[model samples]
Target: SIPDELQLQILELCDMTTLAAICRTNKEWYAKASPIIWSDIDFVELSGDGAYDDGLIDQQRQFFATCSTRMDERPDFWAALAARVQSLKLTRMPGIAISYKSKAELNDSNDYIFIEIWPRDRRNIYDVIAEFKNLHTLYLFVKDWWEFSSIGESEKAVAHNLEKLTNLKVGGQINQDMMLALLSRPENIQHLSLINLIHSPGQDNGPNPVLFLRSIQKRFTNLKTLHMSKLAELTEDTNITGARWEFDPAAEIDLLEEWADFLRHVSATL
Candidate 1:
């Protein structure tokens, strides 16, 4: 009965689109009859409107940032909510402004000021994601190229910091450098889905980037899944050793087989 009332209150406060994520907290919650909240909000349509200008995104980001900054201030609040959250879906449009306040306390040399930025830049986004440490599933729906690049900026941090994350769905260009950085981390990530990875044409005579990823597949023992879609740079002679190994076929075979075995296992699971 209490959960019913709490669910109703949640329905009133949360965006209707987010109800699916809320109900996924547990089986019991999903079994209880309730309207799908998202149908009521028309999120796909209204999301393009100025929802952030009315102080929704700022309020939530600030709330979560404070909870993360001060462990003692709201320990119970953060701990309890972390249990309920399983999937987090994020969408960013150009010109959406988010405000930031450092939770660090006052000191003689310390300065306190509010920072504001649009979520269309890579470097700024890293600062924004420092708050969400417990996220497991992240889905992004980017509308434009700028939005796409911004998501790529934060993907590295998401893979490294969110050690609990198993699923990541991105609709953007995932560069080889970012992928390598993610694979280098010693986290328990098992699933990686990159959609529409467009190859930027350049005269890069260095080691082929895809070979670098294959190398990482050999090195990262826990990687279980990789889906590379719409990649345009597939070539047969992309060399990993480039002049380092002197084109040694035996060494290449060993490395390639190691990576192939890992990918084969991941493919079977998927």
Candidate 2:
């Protein structure tokens, strides 16, 4: 028989399908392969119009349900598997379409259902995340603004406790409080990316650009790579001129100065 260490090394090179096959072969191999299979969980490629396939919806729902629990009541095998996860990626999907309801009625129904179910689902998801004490990387992409806001609200506490995190990428709308929570372990983070960010309408809802830059400059001393796209403060016009929003010349000058100062501070480290 091959040595256990060598077998594990072999399993590490295997893909998910191979790992699954190995797990079904015998108990010893299952023990060795399952952790590797579950270590880097990804749901980012789950994309569709939400009506293309009912099976897809069912599969997604099953995954969420399974992750909702940290397997406290389940067997130790599952708990052990959950603990092995080091990276995770999730993306929000479109709602199911129902033909029985009118457009307005369907939207109203879905809104009510989503409002009720999402919080519970989010809580469960975070509960599992909390179980991942060894988690190092996380990526989340949410297309819906409301869902993004809801996720931000739920992410504060769980994300604050992720001491081992080093890389994080988020694509959605983020508020000031959420940003603060995400940056709680800034000392450990080396890579940060914020993409496709949507601007909140009010000043209170969105992060202040000056303050954000200052935080990046001061807190994230270990940051090596920073990428942000579609950021609101950098692109939004502060002034409304007759029926259109126009960029204020004064604000542009001030923003440029702030960026210059921030860059100067982080130039040595970045």
Candidate 3:
């Protein structure tokens, strides 16, 4: 047998099927190879109308459900396996993905697309987060399709000790609730990306998006990189003034002016 480190180095390059076979060879091999296989995972679904030719969606859902169940039944074992996960990516399909564009303008969709993020049960969402204590990079988008979020960021379940999290990217309308919650608790984050921070429509006077962005910049000043997709969303761009890029601005004129002020402040801060 090769040295454990060298064995793991070779095993790291092997695909899942090959690793599965090698793992079955013996308990020792399985023990050595297990963590490498579960370290980085992409929870994705089939493209288009979510018609899984391979039932991939359900398979992943079952896998997630099984993992969540293990957390409840075998806390130590589940934690050990889940802690091995250092990088996690969640992607929803295009049409149903996170979007600030309308179908009429984008000309991409003729109908609405429904998506799901935690199919097992809403509680599984938090339960799953609690498992990955060592997560370093977390990208979440379109896990579930909900216009209005039922989850809150301030909830006790969301307070998972994410001391290791450094990178966060939000591309779609996946978990607006989670995004909002995470923003409320910005910790040790170095990289941040927000494509479209969708939330329940806000009033003109308060809870402004510009103000929201300012608060985020101030809270995450340690951010080495910050990405905001629709720059026009926070400012007055004469070129795309009427572009209506994904932001509803509530058609409030004062909101637009405040957004322009927010843009100036953000530019100066950066």
Each prediction's whole-model lDDT (CA): 0.44, 0.56, 0.53
Model 2: ten consecutive residues of lowest lDDT: 93-102
Model 3 residue runs over 4 Å out of place are: 15-25, 43-56, 93-122, 174-177, 184-187, 200-211, 230-246, 249-270
**Mind giving the per-residue lDDT tens digits that candidate 2 earns over 161-192?**
67788888876545545555666777788888
lDDT of 3: 0.53
Q: Is 1 or 3 the stronger prediction by TM-score?
A: 3
Candidate 1 local lDDT, 1-270, one digit each (tens): 576787676665765445656678787655442243321322233356534332333334453355445444676665554444455555432222233443232112312122233344523433334334565665542222222243454656655666565666554323555455444442455677665432222223312223344454444445566765432333533442222212134434543564567566455444
Q: Cα deviation in Å at residue 138, candidate 2?
A: 1.1
Listed per candidate, the RMSD to the true structure in angstroms reads 12.4, 7.5, 8.9
Q: Where in model 1 is the C-alpha error above 4 Å?
A: 1-86, 92-123, 141-160, 181-187, 199-212, 219-227, 231-265
Candidate number of the best lDDT: 2
Residue-level error in angstroms, candidate 2, position 190 = 0.8
What tens-digit string does per-residue lDDT give for candidate 3 at 168-218?
Answer: 877644343455455555647677777644443223322223224444544
Q: Which model is ahead, 1 or 2, in terms of TM-score? A: 2
Per model, state how many residue pairs clash.
Answer: 2, 0, 9
Error of 1 at 86 (Å): 4.4
